[model samples]
Target: MPRGKQTDTKLTLVSQFFYPDTSANANVLSELAVGLEERGFDVSVVTGQPAYAPNDRRDDQPRREMYKGVAVRRIFSTRFDKNESTVKRMANDVVFFLSAFLHLLFKRDEMGVLLLPTAPPFLPILGWMLSRVRGYEYVPVVLDLYPDMAVELDYLSEDGVVYRVWDQLNKRAYQAASLTVTIGETMEETLTEKYGPCETAVVHNWEDGSVIQPKEKANNEFSRKHDLVDPTTILYSGNHGMHHDLESVVEAAATLEDSREEDLQFQFIGEGGRKVTLVRMTKDRDLDSVSFLPYQPVEQLPESLTSGDIALVSMQEGVEGLCVSSKFYTAIASGQAILAIANEETEIARIVEEVNCGIRVDPKRPGQIVSAIEHWLDNPDEMRAMGERARSVFEERYEKEEAIDRYATVLRRVTT
Candidate 1:
């Protein structure tokens, strides 16, 4: 690299995943890499092989490549079929954390700015080990506090040995970070309670407008191929896993069954641990009002979402405030109304209410979900108002321009 204006700050974004993967960590980190580079930072990335997105497992490919302007080093990791066994997934996490730590250990001699965020929650352990051995500038981004939130959500048991170990790693990662940034107010608050507000700051999420736009027609020949449509379409696109516990969604569909008077249709498009079970629940109950499909690329989101009259964002029981779904920003930017099903007290619930862009149904109450969806579908005028509100919220809070600027400012703050 030449000695440019950014020569003073040869920053490297470190994670176990990057772009070409549709996960939120990949999308956010990719944007951060490009944005920081544009803001006069000599940027590169140190990551693992493409362990996710567009691929079911860790791909057998070259160890390194460049995407656009970012220099990337893809280290080796245990093969992980994201769609496969839970044991394999855990093993992948262990390997990814160790490999990333080793990669950073070698980089520490010349490290400038190291940006480490979550994918495998223990990446911070790598950040800590690398920084302590050879002190380097680091900005720890906490997407979620492992074992803390996960344990709270019951994704991991409170007293599990792994959770206990991760709880220590979580504290150490925070203790070592020069500055910390989080994606939601709830997370910011949580960090404050632990680390105090001095070093941590709230940089709530924003949209990647580059890949998202108003695709008037979904253009999904698959929808046509399947012949699925109705009076109104309410689509939920993202993880359909255990944490999502989509039973209430199915129950809502069943509750609305007798009313057959309303033609509202629920479309679930994504993959997860709970998907098969969700499908079975919907099947055994014979709920004809809902449909399911596989995940798609981020680029296809606008088309997929705008194809419907409304978009849906839901949190499973006991999972509220654990994390914010990146899809909320996408759905908002799509200029579509969102029916957010979440606890009435969480950050997501606050967003839906503040945006006034859609209804907020008690996610635990299947009956309430049914009633809210019905009322929204039954009123076109209100729906249009909700869409406009949705767009307004996106422009004010979630647009790419705004988000990039926020990140750039934070980069300068932590690096300088």
Candidate 2:
């Protein structure tokens, strides 16, 4: 790994968040940086200060630091500000795009390869702009598709100026990049169909030494302390945004409020834009069956996950092809059964149905969710079998070791 060797190639990874950000994209890019470095690439990451996870925060740290032998350069960003409005978040993305675009321009000539794992959706444009400089091969590792996804989540209008501009830029960026990578096969297929087979690839995200499956204590301190002594626990952790329409879960909870399913509780863990309204609705209805827990630390993930009998992984009605909740992978690794809330045709639903991995309910239907929960509770053998199936699916497709090996190979092949 000597510097300036004939075979030595410097690769730069750009993202909005890095190591300390607990989001899926941040975790994926951090691992990619470390993985590529180990594979003998001169890996350098350019990211904004972490606004979400403390570990990803870089505002107080120096502009640059060596992270696990990878050189990480933090670009200035305003996302670190607390309680950002929707407008503020959009503005933050704009600022990061400009700052990151400038940084890439400055280093364009030095990098043999440039990788951006979904941070600012504007990155494809920035990457294309930087690739205009000689000697830079822009590699876009897409964690999620924008415009389409944003529209699905109601973040942007389908025909809005922003969407129209981004759509064109994204297509051009896809055409311009040396390779475009995604987190799973479904996304690979989706991107392939959309852009007509540019060098797109799949590399799922993984957990590192920083995170451990939380030990599922028979009694989670949060559950016990909060007196959530339900007969069955269905836990959903991560952002509770519009993307996570809790209406179905709420409706199911209401339907089962008078039922004797003592352990059947729905616990939501994590913060998001819709949290306030969601919580208010829950409180208004006196839904004691539902409880909210603040997201726990990585060290406590195993225990946090163990708090529930079942794990809930869901998405908005659409964007099924474009995004898979990385949280579902974590639940699988935790060896928990999943009650997937998504479209029937999605890879997630396919895995759940094909493997019988817990439950698959149209998240739009509370009655269906209630029935699924009741069925699982009434048939413990069936439920436990689904848990086993979920774990098998993880070992077969989403295991970190396998995913990282694929990524390592991609880094080499694209650069070679």
Q: What does candidate 1's lDDT look like per residue over 1-416, in tens digits? A: 22244556777787877876667667778887877677678788877666664453544555677776777777778666655766777787888877777767766646687877877876766767777787876777777666676776565798889888877776777877877878888877777676444477667777766556554433544344445443477777777755564788888888787775766677898887778788999889988778887776565555665666687887765655457777788788777788787777767789889868988887677888777877876777898689788878787788776776787777777666
Clashing pairs in 1: none
Query: For model 2, how does the per-residue alpha-carbon lDDT over 153-241 read when each residue is reduced to its tens digit?
Result: 77789879989988888888898888888877888888878777588777777654224443344456755655554457788888776
Q: What do the candidate models score in CA lDDT, each in turn?
A: 0.72, 0.75
Error of 1 at 314 (Å): 1.5
Clashes of each: 0, 17
Q: In model 1, which runs have C-alpha deviations exceeding 4 angstroms?
A: 1-5, 53-61, 196-198, 215-230, 297-299
TM-score, predicted candidate 1 vs. hidden true structure:
0.91
lDDT of 2 at 365: 85
